[model samples]
Target: MRIKTKGFKKRTSVDEALKILLSHTPLPSIEEIGISRGLNRVLACDILANIDVPPFDRAAMDGYAVRAEDTFGASQTNPIYLKVAGEVKIGEAKEIEVKPNEAIKIATGAPLPKGANAVLMYEYTRELDEEIEVLKPVTPGKNVSFKGEDVKKGEILLKKGRILKPHDIGLLASFGIEKIKVYRRAKVGIISTGDELVNLGEKLSEGKIYESNSYMLASLVKTSNSIPERKGIVKDNKEEIKKAIKEALSNDVIIITGGTSVGKRDLVPEIIAEIGKILVHGISLRPGEPTGFGVIEDKIIFMLPGNPVACFVAFETLIRPMLQKMQGLSLMAYSHYLVAKGILKRKIPSEIGRRDFVRVKFDGKYVEPIRVSGAGILSTLVRADGFVIVPENLEGFEEGEEVEVRLFHNYFPAP
Candidate 1:
């Protein structure tokens, strides 16, 4: 009982393909939250300030909160004098006020005493027993940080879903914020499907490769602030694959790798057909040609290509963005820079009917192809900075012509 898509046509653009995934209620919810200092959590809501930053009028200079008029015409040669009422230390505050022709000593960050409108720097003053001589003119409202200057009460400090970086914490601490609400990370499910795949510790048999795709996928998910629920390796057997997909769908987005391509064990697509609807198969893309999508019990089942590089690239480029969206991040175009030097001049090979992503690396001044052979070479992917997608209308890229590259970046910092 399989509902497989046959005579595959590449109608799926990357964006259109992703939208089809949402036909079911496949997104993770935001209710699951646990606190751990919230160091790196995305904000669940915009934070409005309960208190003003600085809390009161404060001195922005270490000098005197002065009656600016009293310092009028003051000069080094002909200094104007005003009685020094008192000093306002950096931390302490008082109820003192100043009348006309008066001033008070103030340090930087000290709250301004009542009736004082400006500050004069310490370098512009000379002291006397009963008064201080102002050697420089002071203007009204100079060197003062007004109450709520840095931020006002009830102002939106951080928008909902903004990731809390280190500096974000400092702003909260400075404003006396001890806690905040942030969106919990969405949980993701990672499963590897293939009889040829073995555990990492196991010695490689003649045709068996150690299970690295699962670990790689898990790490990628974790880096994006998503929790990865690893369901380990499932053999290519139909029923086994079905059970794995069933369990993974229980978590969040289900990512199944290995049995996606057409092979003896490429039964993952077949199994999903029994349980769900295959949205798209045989994407018109390189390195990840066998990519497919389905919905299983309201969960997304992404059958990523089995090759390690293909799996790695597909997750980072295609899947990570969707996860970012689930965490409340508004989807937007991000720029990925590609720096490379061209070595050869030739036409690129691609049908005008499909888009091809060509892997390239930096050669000092320009990008160069790291893999002239094909997408199966994971090692060459390690050398690439980004990809130049060759469109189907164009047979190939002219070797010497500069090209646009879709760079792959670790958008989330590596854990």
Candidate 2:
């Protein structure tokens, strides 16, 4: 079946579709009780370093801190031994200053003693007469990490919009940063509509399926590091649909799945027309032919296809970006894109004016095409590595044609 949208242009261009999506009201500002240890949450602002890393000059190894000139010509055959004046423990300092032929024993991360310019590892010497023998000659400033060596004060350690990682956390801790400021989470509302859809754990009946799309969409929203509020499922009645949509519009963004495809009972677009402008009734795309974009009282409303794989693909391609934008992130977090060759030969039909994203597997660095079928076949998505973009102007991919594949999940980093 083809798109049934009438008047003011029928076949939607990718650019037009994007422009239409952007035409909707920007997501509203919301207040949320934020949490720490955020993995993929977009940063609210730039993080500047208040303290220099290392804080002070410290020894890098368990060794002796001595004047370099005293052991300048020390060798393995005839070593120089300095009198062990005292010992410095890690995170402690000594009051005594080192003079000629005098050394202070220091452990790893210990502050350097006064008048000491170099450190000699314990492996390079032996102990005799309460003095350590240095086999290797020393140079000035060797084996010592200076204050601000790794990072300087006032340096922008982690930039704004960066999704926090384990390494980022360690870097923050190195600067004595115990807590940080992050942006408030995006508040999203979900509404699932269908008389045939029943709640989970209920007894199954003919022509009835559990309402899994709402839960799946909610999980995806959570995975994107946002808050998902379930608005519950409504029946096929138009008045109830309008009321449910209006209620959800009170949030930052709203997502309505099912009741989107063009059937006698699919009143999603009609109901959207009653409440607000229908920016896009049917996107020129595959699997999600029933997809639509619109607005309801300043909140963005997206009608996604009822099928599982279709909804999943639409969320990755469409809904994910909007949520990131609302969170102040410039790009989609936790997503990667790259180009690879098709391994197996197959042909798939795409809409005349719409682009198609076909799933394929990674054969080494290149992708091998798989038997991608209807959106109802959930296993097709499980077996795929990523999806390829088939341009609307050209025919579908051939056996060995290279294409751009947008990854669905992590495991393959951008090449």
Candidate 3:
């Protein structure tokens, strides 16, 4: 194969490249799924409450139901006595009435009896056979959970584009909602291409390395709440890569790793341009400058670098947002990553025209930038806690400067 010496004629800015990709992305079709499987799925439509939550006036505590006036002026010095009329347990449907000067035993979450306005705790009353002595005055509506207190009928329980959570599922279950309308998860096809790549469990030859980009990309897809279909590996040959691209067009998005730069072996970009329109072929970003994307048969195709760390950065910076948009979620919906401010332990060097993602280890008090000679060093990502983005306008950050670090894992405890 003849090598091409010409580099990228012009590289697009990171912001412009992302804008182009999102313009071509459309929300996936909606589907009705059971609430049991709705966690992390985006809602297709606003869900309105058909009935009020808690459905009725109920007791918030285990106590005796009685009219407020009946317990008025009751104290330890001068206790008021009332007849014990009946009892109400949780989920019970029997109608019980609290007549004047009478009290009924009620359990927590049980429906408040008719003609009762308040609940006097058992601690304030002494059970004396058929009657009880009230030692504390009770206020109206005390210890009572009124109907629609949690959710009102005809109110919006959840809005469209909301990502369902465990508590959301429980809330839907409270309304007896078996199924909910949610956006369908996007099906992503991942294709890894290179001549020196081999799958796991295969023999390790002198010139071949185990392919890992596909596995890493697949996990990133899952984190975006999408399904990944691994298309396996294809050699650098044109015909083989073309066939793989054609087959992967069935997916909503196609990610081709390796052969994305301007080299003779970088046939993936040429094939993508031949079969479809290459919208953005290069970006002004560190480690992922060769990253590019296009559209084929209405499917978005991403050409990522073979280096594992570069592939990860490209996916997180560009592809992840598009995937989220396809699933009916806002681009910033999953932007709840933990951020911490710390003093820089060392200086970070960068160019002014390119955006740089500097991997750093944040030790609660200081942000230490991890230096790597090349983007192929994937171990740097593992050793670092998170990364800090240096914008294109600025050259770099000085030591001792306070900077915000975006954490890779949000669940990390406070330092």
Candidate number achieving the greatest TM-score relative to the actual structure: 3
Model 2 lDDT per residue over 267-313, tens place: 88888877786778667666676777888777788888888888887
TM-score of each prediction:
0.88, 0.89, 0.96
lDDT of 1 by residue, 1-415 (tens): 2333353444576566656654443444454343336667788878888898879999999988987877889898999888888888988968788777788888899999898889999899988897788999978889999988889999999888777888888887777777777665777888887778899788898998878777878888887788898889888688888877777777778888887866656888888777888887777566676888787776777889888777765675567777766776755433224333344334556776665667776444566766644655676666776666666567777767777655555332632
Give candidate 1's root-mean-square deviation (CA, Å).
3.0
Per-candidate Cα lDDT values, in order, are 0.74, 0.75, 0.88
Which residue pairs clash within candidate 2?
343-368
Q: Which ten contiguous residues of candidate 3 have the minimum total lDDT?
A: 406-415
Best by lDDT: 3
Residue 45 error, candidate 1, Å:
3.2
Candidate 2: worst 10 consecutive residues by lDDT? 1-10
Q: Candidate 3, residues 1-415: lDDT per residue as tens digits?
A: 2223546768899989989999999857899999999998989999999999789999988989999999999999999999999999999976779999999999999999999988889999998999999999999999999999999999999999898888989999999899999999989999999989999999999999999999999988888889999999999999999999999988889999999998777898788878898898889988899999998998899999999888988998898889888887667522646888999989988888888888899988899999733689888988888888888898899999999898876633110
> With candidate 2 superimposed using the best TM-score fit, by how many Å does residue 116's alpha carbon deviate from the native?
0.6
* Residue pairs in candidate 3 whose N, alpha carbon or C atoms collide under 3 angstroms: none
lDDT at 207 for candidate 3? Answer: 97
Worst 10 residues of 1 by lDDT: 332-341
* Models, CA RMSD each: 3.0, 3.5, 2.5
